[model samples]
Target chain A: MISTFIRHELKAFWRSKNTGKSIAVRIVMIFLILYLFGCILLAGIGMDKILEIAFPNDDLVKSFCGIVLIYFLFDLFMRLQLQELPTLRVQPYLHLPIKRNTLVGYLAITAVFSMFNLWPFLLFLPFIFKIIAPDSGIIVALAFVVAIIGISVFNNYLALYLKRKSNLNGWIFLITAAVLILIVIADFWWHFYSLHNISYAFFGRLLTMPILAIIPALLGIVMYYFNFLYLKQNLYLETLTARKVKIYKSNTDIPFLSRFGTIGDLAANEIKLVFRNKRSRSSLIIGLFFMFYGLIFYTNKSLGQGWYLFAGMYMTGAFVVNYGQFMFGWQASHFDGILVSKINFSDFVKAKYLLFTTVSAISFVLTIPYVYFGWHVLLVHFVMCVWNIGVTTTIVLFFANRNFKRIDLSKSGTMNWEGVGASQLLLTLPLILTPYIIYTPFAVFKHPDIGLALLAVTGFIAILTRNYWIKQLEADYYSKRYRIAEGFRNK
Target chain B: MIEIKNLKKIYGNVTVVDIPHLSIAKGESVGLVGNNGAGKTTLFRMILDLILPESGEITSNGEIVAGHEHWKAYTASYLDEGFLIEYLTPEEYLYFIGGLHQQSRAQVDETLTALGDFFNGEILNRGKYIRDLSKGNQCKVGVASCLLQNPQLLMLDEPFANIDPSTQFRLKNMLKDANKSKGVTTIVSSHDLNHITDVCDRILLMEKGVIIKDIATSSSTLSELEDYFGVGQTVGATPVVKIDEEENH
Candidate 1:
């Protein structure tokens, strides 16, 4: 049964419409995984030497034991973000002769085959052989290895359970994140208790008495059973279909936008599109998170002024670059209606301009607190804001005309390459490099202020000549609209 | 109000729409009937300027449709689910479309109240996005939005394919009333011979990418189309092609 399921999965992957693109992504991912595992293996082999150097006065084995729990804690955090639940088309098999328990058991077992489960062995196995075997004897070392495997399994099922619960009620996700943050703060900032000492107390006993290792193994069994029960209870088609009929509240109208007329209406709809869909909502969240980007460079006093410009540009314009690159593709689902409706193409272009400027302006205002780093930081962000509105908006929309792939808005954005095309990849070049090209010569000659002035002037001039750019965009859109519509139709 | 001149759209080697000249007059209720792959959709797309033709032009009210924004002021179309903004609720979608035509919210609500029976109580105030609605209900939303536009030119492709029987009757009446009362030029394509014969004053039969027959609707129109399609015939009976010759003569 498992072999048949694996064969079907392989066929689905190979037969998918985006097989060529997925194959390329897979090759890149494989190289990345190998590189990460290679680093972990080297770290494992040299663990004793590193421990001795870092903790010169403390016992090496005790320090290593203290780090084990910390490693797993970090492992659990990473797993929560990266792990995917194992899904099978069990509907077809539910009415067949196969037992429901067998399907649930299959899902639970396959869920264990993830990179999170493999990283522990790569990072801990060599340490176990070199340090623990001769000192604690082979049997004790084996028990320690069993404990590591047990804890890894426990973490796997626990993360999957929490993720499933969160899917049913979203507050579970927020509460889990809050609890994790509180744990970090209580241990590190409040000094309420010490996790390192607690970790040593648990793992150090395994080194002396091998029987204590059974505790983690037992915990692993309990989590596995919990997941199995959860799956069996919620396996019915009724539960699956019933969860999708969520009661949606109508979006309230923004009275302020009514003053702008049709352009305002279009922009208001775009805002709802961003908030209502999973992929677009995540994109907006990521843009908001990038407001902290200046913290990395602005804190470093050694960097040149040009580096500040780069960070400031990114901080204020992240949403413009992130969301604007897929401008027309976001509307691919209704592009036909847009083409034939009572809307002028120029008004459509104006609405996009309106959305970009509004978002960029809000991003700039949020970065005003960065002036505490230096007044220069705020000045640079202001210039970048103008550049984003006038220059980057045009570049992004220009590249948008070439992107025809339709985005499925229902899917999450993390690691999703659904609407991505070569145009999206190429768009990043001019966006990042164009400012540097204009700013480099002045910085090299020690006249950095002149470069900033020149950039602001260029942006100002573009703003003044906005009508010309709008006409150019309208023409470009008309020429490529047919091809874009055709591509969208194919999907 | 729509004119096509030598309009041809080719997909690789096959020409999908190759009409030399086809014109729709004001207030004309036209029915387009054809089998699968008969270029009915491609022709509609060309007329709406969604698909650029290989070697010709389409015009609305004597202005070229390509690169012109004025035509959109009077044209409204619903070809498929692609025409719907699926994330919006039915009421929200209707209001959005109505807003484009400068219709007030009260006006839109009044129109919805009138369309309540056509919607069959499944659409408005349902607290469901259009994407979550069933196919038949989604079609009702699409058709209702087109009506809200109050467009001088309205086009719909296969609107009856996914609708219920009673709703189909209501839609036929709506199209007829739009043509007679408001002078709205409607182009509807359907596979149902009975519905097309009842709703349309003129019917155009398409084959491959060409119009094989064009006739005024009469008592014999439905049977003539049925004969060409070989409906109610015994197994292995070929569709009659002589109707094309007769129509040409």
Candidate 2:
């Protein structure tokens, strides 16, 4: 049954749309994994020597043991953000004469194939072979390997269970991320206590009493059972249907945008889409998070001024690049109605322009506190704000007409690449590189002010003729309406 | 109300919608009947300008449907769930549609009140997004929203496909009343022969993207279609092809 399920999964993946692109991405990902493995292998082989040189007074094993907790914590954080739920068509099996336990076991076992389970062994196995084997003999080294595998498995199931729980209630996800952030801040910034001491207390003793390695292995078993029971209880199709939260019907419109007539109503719909859907709503949250991006480069007095230029552009145009790249994709779900509705193409384009500019303007204002970095930073941000409103907005919308993939708005937003196409990838080139092309030559010649002025002038001219750009976009969209509608209806 | 000239939509090698010329006049109650893959949807999509034809044109109200804004004013269509914005509640969705046609909130509320029986008290004020509604309720919402605009040219792909029998009867009566009172140029497609014949003044029978029969509705019209479909007769393709050839004259 498991083999048949796996075969079905392979068939579904191969027959999916854009199968060629998915295969290409997989090949690239394979090379990346191998490269990371090489780095970890080298790090493990040379850890004993490096530890002695860096900490001459401390024991090498103690020093190594101190960082294991930190490594797993970071691993857990990355898994929370990057790991995808292993998808199995559990629906068909639910009706057949199959035990629920077998299905849940298949899901849990397939999840172990993830890279998170391999990372620890890649980094630690060589160390145990070269150092622990000779120093404490092979049995203790073997015990440590067993413990490492056990803890790695523990983190895998635990992360999967937490993520599954979080999907049911978003607040659980938010609180988990917050708690993780607080731990990092407390350990690194406040220095109120030390995770190193706690880690060493448990691991350093393993060298003396290798029999104690059984604890981590036992913990991994407990975690697997926990995940199994949780999943078995919640895997019903009915439980997955509706959000458990009670909803209040509040039929309201954006009071300010409603004044623009139909255009306002269109923009209002777009606004509600951005706030209501998971994929779009996160784009807004992430854009706001990046408003603090300047703090990274600005506070580093040793970094080059070029870094600030990059930061300034990103902070001001975060909303534009994040939300604008998806363009008409937000409406791909109901594009048929959009095509048939009594709406003018020009008004539709204008409403998009209004949405982009409004978000950019709000982001720009939120980023103003970064002026404490320098007046120079403020000028760069202000210039990019204009550039975003003018050139970036036009470019984003132009490429938007070319994006035809439909996005499922109900899915989780973290790593789902639904509506992405070649256009979104190519769009980043001009969005980031165009400013550098114009700015680099002037800065190289030591006339940096001229570069800023030229960029601002170009943006100012583009903003001045927003209507002309809107008309051009309207014409482009008119020709692609049928194709876009057809693409969205592919399901 | 709608015109098609040499319209053709080909998928790879299949001519999905190959109509030489078809015209729907104002205030005509036209019903399109066909089995699946008979190009009913493709033709409706072309008329709505949601799908472009490779070799012809659809002109709604004398304006080219491809790149113009004039035709949408008098025409409103609901082909499938694609016509709905599922994130909003039914009431909110209705209000949004009404606002597009420049209908005020009070006017929309009045319309919803009139269709309360059609809704059967499960739609409005239910605090449910259209996505969460049952399939039949979603259909009711889709059809009712189209009515909110009172468009002269209204189209629904299958209004009675999943609806209950009683609601289907109410909808048939409501559509007949709408056509008589407002002179709405309504076009609907359905597989249900009894309801379509009861509601439509004329029926167009399609087979393999071709209109094989065009007949004015009469007491015998339903039985003829049933025979062509081989529903209550000896099942074979012979009688259907004979009727097609006989109707060509």
Candidate 3:
């Protein structure tokens, strides 16, 4: 009966339009990741021919397996955040002859088969086959993959159940904070000790005999049962109701630019929309954290150089485009009224660009602390801020004008293809390459500053041409208002 | 005056609304009535240019709805609390809309005074975000926000839905004053025919994406609406009784 419920969910997924889209997206992601991994593996093999690290062969393999498992854990955590489970569907199933345990059990089982489970294997299998096949230990790779996938399944279900439980108890953020702390601790230990190679160490132990793979595999099975128990106990409406109320309350408290008068009011409203709305808020938070990502590459003597400026700008600006690219469509749910209101569509677009610029400015200011060690770093931050405000904001707003799907902020980041479309991709192409493709030639030749100047100028022009962009946004809003509204009305 | 001519809307090969022509004179209190999917909301949205009709045009005071030209100076709509920025407290939302129309904060306060009872005692002072309010309270805030603007044209979709009985009666009076006293052209959509019959100068009965009946409320007998909704006459038959059954504990 449990299997039947699982099959029923599978059937429903197969029938859903969104599920079809999800599957297509998953398949594409799988192939893309696999192709990328294949290329990387080939590169690694080529690199191995040129240079080999002195670490033992088994150590490398175990390291490879450990990396695969770590990626799976991160992927599972992200999947939980991005694709909040459709617990609403359970409402109907509850009334059916189906027992709750059967439904939940099936859900957990189905979770194991998610694409998050597939990609790690794609990356791991090729590396194992390339390196370990000669050792006659291919089964270690296969068994490790299975165990990692099982643990990932366990993690996904546990995270979802915990989220559901938190939703009921208004402790979602608290639970998430706890989980994040644990993951951070794990990451800290892993990074400090270079323990990514631990799996290779374990696999080396297992290589002599295939039966040793059973150890981790059996542990994975135990964790899966624990997940099953958690889901079974908390599968009720009462818990979910608690979560809903808490979510509703938190939504009200999200900070915004409330002090700026009417424009401030508007900005505050946009801030609330970005924060209170589940999907957009996650992107915002991700963007906020991503501000520090530039520091990863720009450090010490390498900092303040042309490459650092461009790379830092590109990295940070990528976030501006990433989070701001969806802009108005994030409000597609009520975009009709917003479109028709006395507010100018240009002002609306301007407001978004302004907000993105504001965030970029804040990010640039934050980077100033990093700049103190090298005052020249401020030059990079200055140029990047201009590029982000000028080029990135315009590009983001341009595609944002074209985006029609009303993304459910709560459900965003969970599913693979939640808010993606052709325009969004096309928007990204220019954003990624423009800094390099257009400016690199100048920089590579005699004048690096000229390239930087060009970036700033282009971005400046984009920013200065606010009226033109506004007109364009208004036209787009008029043309697509109904389509946008219809998209939002879907769910 | 507002004019809608040959308005048609299609969703995935299915036409949801196709109206040949419709017009409401200045100061006309028009009530839109329809079944659940009967294109009433769609029509109101069209008038506000919230949704564009595939083929046809809507004009208000001689300006097309597509551009901001006419709508710039005159038009206000509250289809739902979605139009209300949910994070705002009721006071903030009211002031925000008031500020949009250049209403002084004092005027905003004075206007809320007229509709004060709609919110129970000091609901605005409750410090609860409008989003955190119960459905009934949310609707009251929305209604108050829309009315606060005092624009020439007002569009409210199911304004009275979720509003308590006392508040509903007060909103009706407010609508009546906005029309009769201020000469505001008001188009309101509701499933409750009697409430509309009591206030609207013109009543349109919509069925399945078409206006089956467009009768002046002053000309048509109350029995006509009763018959249309498939209900027998009472002293102003309450269509909301069905809604009340669900709203009441």
Q: List, for all models, the DockQ compared with the true complex.
A: 0.54, 0.56, 0.29
Candidate 2, residues A235-296, lDDT tens digits: the string is 87644333445556566668989888888888888888888787888988888888888888
TM-score each candidate.
0.90, 0.90, 0.78
Model 3 lDDT, full chain set: 0.69
Candidate 1, residues A82-126, lDDT tens digits: the string is 686665356677888887788888878988988789898988888
Local error of candidate 1 at residue A421 (angstroms): 2.0
Quantify how close model 1 is to the true structure by its C-alpha RMSD in Å: 5.8
State how far residue A26 of model 1 sits from its true place (Å): 6.3
Q: How do these models rank on lDDT, best leading?
A: 1, 2, 3
User: Order the candidates by DockQ, highest first — what do you get?
Assistant: 2, 1, 3
Q: What TM value does model 3 have?
A: 0.78
RMSD of each: 5.8, 5.6, 6.7
Whole-model Cα lDDT of every candidate shown, in order: 0.85, 0.83, 0.69
- Whose DockQ is greatest here? 2
